[model samples]
Target: DMYQMISDDNPYETPMMIFPASHYTMGGIWVDYELQTSIKGLFAIGECNFSDHGANRLGASALMQGLADGYFVIPYTMQNYLSDQIKVPHFTTDAKEFDEAEKAVRARIEKLMNIKGTKSPDQIHKRLGHVMWDLVGMGRTLQGLVKALAEIEEVRKEFYTDLRVVGRADDLNTELEKALRLEDFLVIAKMMAIDALNRNESCGAHFREEYQLADGEAARNDKDYMYVSCWKYTGDNEKPVLLKEPLNYTEIKVQTRNYKS
Candidate 1:
């Protein structure tokens, strides 16, 4: 892109794109004590697995999680799981299960390629992004969240039915990649809105407009809703089941945060 002549020519000038990210809400995929996800061999480490940080994670803590997960944690934990699998025999891509999975993936790709719509994946994705930002990004309310869910559903429907993938699936197709990722992004956006709606009280990154005090602060209802709410993905356009893992504090007591000085 620099060579494409859109960026600042000067070396001392600011870069093309820079942004703050991953400070808060550093984790999402539910993992066990050993950082293993529901899929047996698939392990989520560092920020990928929901652990290590409080609701609002400071930037510095992500560094520790990264180091700990990469260096110390995943090695011992993954090895434990792998040790048992040593005698299970190595399976290649030619296996029956892998063949079926690959066929399903190729079928999805063909479906996207066959959509033959006018809008690019980027265009549809941008529209989806705008909907999320305006409706569900911040200053969220009951009505807004509900509307966001509706909009996201439309986006999801549009993605599957109207998305145009410009390149061949057999080749290295970046547009196809974007289309696939956009599908997942739509899922995340909907899940976020759904979870926001489920949790009645405002807490951390989820700042519901209805769940606020007169002085304009988050009113966290620990007595009723103090728990890690994990989601079970049902299907496209179906409501995700809310799986709540209640937080029972043993070492410390629950305390309200007073942000006002």
Candidate 2:
């Protein structure tokens, strides 16, 4: 493992090793050139929105993309949005919508606190991580994916019912925050699994066990699966809508992707 290789305890340091963890998100809220989502008021940029990167993200592009979106895109788009909203009066926090939103947030926190569970939130999170790493971590297959989905379902159920937190609701509790973040990670992990499973061919960081070259290199099926898979989250019970945006390669011709000569 990557962690073990990097650790001080390890005698022989390997130059390259697999360190699988919940890293970058390829898909997020759909956005336009202006970084605006489908909702008129909402705007998402950087890693939060699935805009720039297609299937495989290039190195050193993340910084460039984030800066470009933040400095150029957002400023220009906000100007356009604000131009129309200049005459509109600013709403106060005491407004019904704001009050309702606050109430809902508070209620959620209260509900989480009320659950007197035996297992700590970390315990549940560790199990989730193990499940994901075992089945849907590096290379994935149909059997492994199905098993992972079942395990994830069980973890989610345990998380909601048996998870515990140690802190007052008012104060800044790091544990509670971690628990919330872990919950979000769980949802995100599920989406990744679904995306990986649906995509039968291997491409970029997404490597399917069933699709690979004889030498272990990822084989891209551009003719069939050369499209960005954008998933829209509906709700807890509802299935995510899988949207495909086809890649148009005009300048560069389709060629074999290889790092080694």
Candidate 3:
């Protein structure tokens, strides 16, 4: 019976394995109407900007948004911002700000190299990947999220102590690069858990097991949670603070979607 059904219109076998993983984060650095981030003199576009997609992007929309922002939006908006600065003198690397930024980066690199502990960056990252995949990915519960947060802290501690990176920082060190990237990922993972914990209601890709309806579908709480979450980083190892911008729809009425017909 299964073979007959499969032979009717399907091109592959019935039994198969489906693996899940994060494709892209629709939530990213928030941008304004002009495609500029909150910080002045800096701009972000494409997958890095959060303004295009709400929580979950569908199909080819990511490509379309990227192209439109690159070709149409930024060209005009950035020109306006740059119009007044045309007469400004070019900045030299000898400037204080540049020196400080470079020094900070070098110090961070040295710190990572000096650890010289047992576990490699890849090992710690693999443990982190498991924590994220199991506790924070797809299915989520309050208990699981709390566990993930705690486990992330423990992994972060391990990373700071046991992280081993071979090669010199002055040169191109692939292991150092991975260690740095993993360092960033650790913080971002914590932020994810925090945001997930704050938003008790489920919406888009951020599904919470405690906020489901009788039909096992996500139950959105628009009355209380219709806002974009923004986080402000405060120093090293401190918890990020949250700020919300309420979503306002003037032309469209918010309604539940039905895909079954």
Among these predictions, the greatest TM-score belongs to 3
- Candidate 1: the clashing residue pairs are none
Per-residue lDDT tens digits of candidate 2, residues 134-208? 888657788898888888989988988988888888899887887778778778878878888898887766778
TM-score of each: 0.84, 0.77, 0.86
Please say which candidate is ahead in lDDT: 1 or 2.
1
Q: Which ranges in model 3 have alpha carbons more than 4 Å from their true place?
A: 1-21, 24-26
Worst 10 residues of 1 by lDDT: 18-27
Model 1: runs farther than 4 Å from truth?
A: 1-27, 92-94
**Please, what's the RMSD in Å of model 3?**
4.8
TM-score of 1: 0.84
Candidates 1 and 2 compared: the better one by TM-score is 1
Identify the candidate with maximal lDDT.
Answer: 3
Query: Which digits, one per residue and each the tens of the lDDT, describe model 1 over residues 1-261?
Result: 342375546435653343234335334577888889889999988766666764466566667888998999898899899888968987788889998998899888888899988889999999998887787765678999899989998888888777888978899999999998888898898888887788788887777888899998888998889888889899876778888888999999777766664
lDDT of 3 at 11: 35
Q: Provide C-alpha RMSD values for all models, in order.
A: 6.5, 5.4, 4.8
